[model samples]
Target: DAGVTQSPTHLIKTRGQQVTLRCSPKSGHDTVSWYQQALGQGPQFIFQYYEEEERQRGNFPDRFSGHQFPNYSSELNVNALLLGDSALYLCASSVTGGELFFGEGSRLTVL
Candidate 1:
């Protein structure tokens, strides 16, 4: 009965570096969505994965990408990371169009 889970809890990277964050969705969930939350701001949708395909994406640049596994788990990868890319990356799982359960989030800091 585990809820959503995110790995690496924290990270530090330099500009232009690439980073990958992982997530395990809650049981019985089939949709995984990635969000970025900067300090003092609300979460911004990065993209969503369903059936191993990207079903929807936000206003983020092309550098942000994601994948969904058979078990409904997911990964978020950011290429050529920038200072402004540093934020709390959240993984939210839900039965498509239903209520979502969010993970603790992986914090990234770019220097």
Candidate 2:
């Protein structure tokens, strides 16, 4: 079975720009979570989606948002990007509250 997958492996954006990253969850998975990993720091949860509904969110600002589709694929969107927003955006999938399987991650660089 295929693992999680993310598109646009790398991206470059300017401050105030918006970007969207996409992901396809692992087979048989139904929950998707998004994370941001700044250089030298561990992943920080952004939000989680299940059953096409957002279930939990972290300390991130409203500029961070996500969507999960019926097929369990997901998208992460960041608006008004800032230089500090540059990081490895990760997508993880699993059954609700279960162990997570992570994607290769989408790297975003804001200038």
Candidate 3:
């Protein structure tokens, strides 16, 4: 069975640009969460999506946005990207208030 999966396993972007990352949740999951992990640091919660609505968010700036589809897949969009945005973007899926299953993550590099 397929677990969580992310796209563009690795990507590059420049400061002031924009980028979009995608994720597909594991089967039977209805909640999707996003996180950003800097080198040597634990992942920072970015946001969570459920039933096509954003249910929660973290301390990230307004530049970060996300969408959840009825199919339980999601997309993370970062506008006017900054060098500080460089990090591993992780996607996790689970039933609301249940155990989270994480993906390998998509590594984003900003220059």
Candidate 4:
């Protein structure tokens, strides 16, 4: 994905822990979306933000939260982490709910 990237490509955490992952959307894209991909499973939508507002969200619990910046960059924060939270967290960019281009993702492993 052009201009889309994530930080802390890999990380480790423990139960009851919390982590914040960051993403920079593609240039000119006004929306950012987050996804969680467990091993051997397809990505699951976590949430989407635009205009610095959360515009859409998936079925994930309140523990999953995010924010979008004025520059279109974004962040995903997961609190009270569990082993089950281990996954590749992807950040995607689009134009107001248009087609998406995804970053490589940040891998999180919990023990």
Which has the greatest lDDT?
A: 3
Using lDDT as the measure, name the better of candidate 1 and candidate 3: 3
Put the candidates in TM-score order, highest first. 3, 1, 2, 4
- The 10 consecutive residues of candidate 4 with the worst lDDT sum are 1-10
**Tens-digit per-residue lDDT, 57-103, candidate 3:** 99999999999988999999999999999999999999999999999
lDDT of 4 by residue, 27-82 (tens): 88999999999999999999999899999899999999998888889989999999
For 1-111, candidate 2 gives per-residue lDDT tens digits of: 889999999999999999999999999999999999999999999999999999999999999988888898999999999999999999999999899999999999999
Error of 3 at 101 (Å): 0.3
Candidate 1 per-residue lDDT over residues 21-82, each given as its tens digit: 99999999999999999999999999999999999999999999888999889999999999
Q: After superposition, how far is residue 68 of candidate 1 from its true place, in Å?
A: 0.7
Q: Kindly report which residue stretches of model 4 are placed more than 4 angstroms away from their true locations once superposed.
A: none
**Model 4 pairs in collision:** none
lDDT of 4: 0.93
Q: For candidate 3, what is the TM-score?
A: 0.99
